[model samples]
Target: MMIKDIKNYLKSVVDCPNWYVGRIDGKKDQCIGVYPARSQPKPVPIAIGGVENTTYNKLGVEILIHWGDAPTDAEEKAQAVYNALYGQNPEIGGKRVIKIDLNTSCPVYAGVDENGIYEFVLGAVIYYER
Candidate 1:
């Protein structure tokens, strides 16, 4: 339930036109976590935690975004994400989110290709009440 709440929160905060719940083929310029092509930006992915903390109802959520052609692009996008969700406790569905903190964010390798395409990952923990 927390994962579902996290995903729903992401769908509300993220500005991307195409949003995927899981990894997408990286063949496109962008995807949730999959790589497909590089010509244009594709869909973005939001990965949810496999296991939840029954004691606290905490869940790990990650958002993958394309870095675009410049380093500023990546930084800007990262800032946008942080600006959108950090420290804001929004009611997701019937659950009240206690907090959503930015855990970690950095550039990640795109599979084995290691191309020059820009990409960064935003990690967070969403805590909610059951």
Candidate 2:
């Protein structure tokens, strides 16, 4: 559900048409892949009995942008995605997103793949209500 939320959000925000979850479509030279990386629960102290309750979840998401033999296109698309996602709190897929922040300052170049497609990767942490 989180993956679907992320993928749908990206599809709505980013201009690119091809958006996939878990794996990239090999047929499409230019596309984006949204994958789950790591996650943790965000617990808060409750007033009653000083108990900790998890009201939100922090999820790590990895976004991969691939363009056919065009590093610039890949990087540009990655930047667009970064701009669309970073430092934003929006409700998507019926989930209340608290925040989204990039793990790195910019998209990291992942070099060319075996299919000769250029790739750029973005790591982000997304906080949302449980």
Candidate 3:
């Protein structure tokens, strides 16, 4: 619904802050055992990995691809930024985690700019806010 809502929803799905920061060179040095698949719709959503472990009904997959896949100072800290921009936990502990897998198609990224800021996209399973 809203970026804030999405943030909180994502956090709820994964125990981590639900944020990612980094850049990618086309699935280069992303992670381990990353697979690729298509979701649906005419665009053919790409399924990188399993959804956030903390999420249910796959409310995450439907999330638009943004906030990640960019350059930032810290990758993990990006989650915190994402949270602030997104939403806060309504009642912490209500949900322990949100899990998403980072498949090949949806590889995470970390900016290799002069500043060397890390970034990432809302990957599938492995591509979570951890």
Give per-model TM-scores: 0.62, 0.84, 0.26
Q: List per-prediction Cα lDDT, in the order shown.
A: 0.56, 0.82, 0.33
Best by TM-score: 2
Per-residue C-alpha lDDT of model 3 across residues 44-97, encoded as one tens digit per residue:
243466444423322222222222234342445444434432323232224323
- Per-residue lDDT over 9-126 for candidate 2, one digit per residue giving the tens place of the 0 to 100 score: 8898888768899998867888999998755334434545443455666677898998778778888888998898877888877889898878899999999988899999888878
TM-score: model 2 vs. ground truth: 0.84
lDDT of 2 at 81: 89
Off by more than 4 A, model 2: 38-53
Give the top-scoring candidate (lDDT): 2
Q: Can you give the lDDT of residue 8 in candidate 2?
A: 93
Query: Tens-digit lDDT track for model 1 on 1-130?
Result: 4445555666677665445555644555543432222232222233355334333455566666654556566556656656666778888767777887665544333322255446666666666666
Q: What local lDDT does model 2 show for residue 42?
A: 46
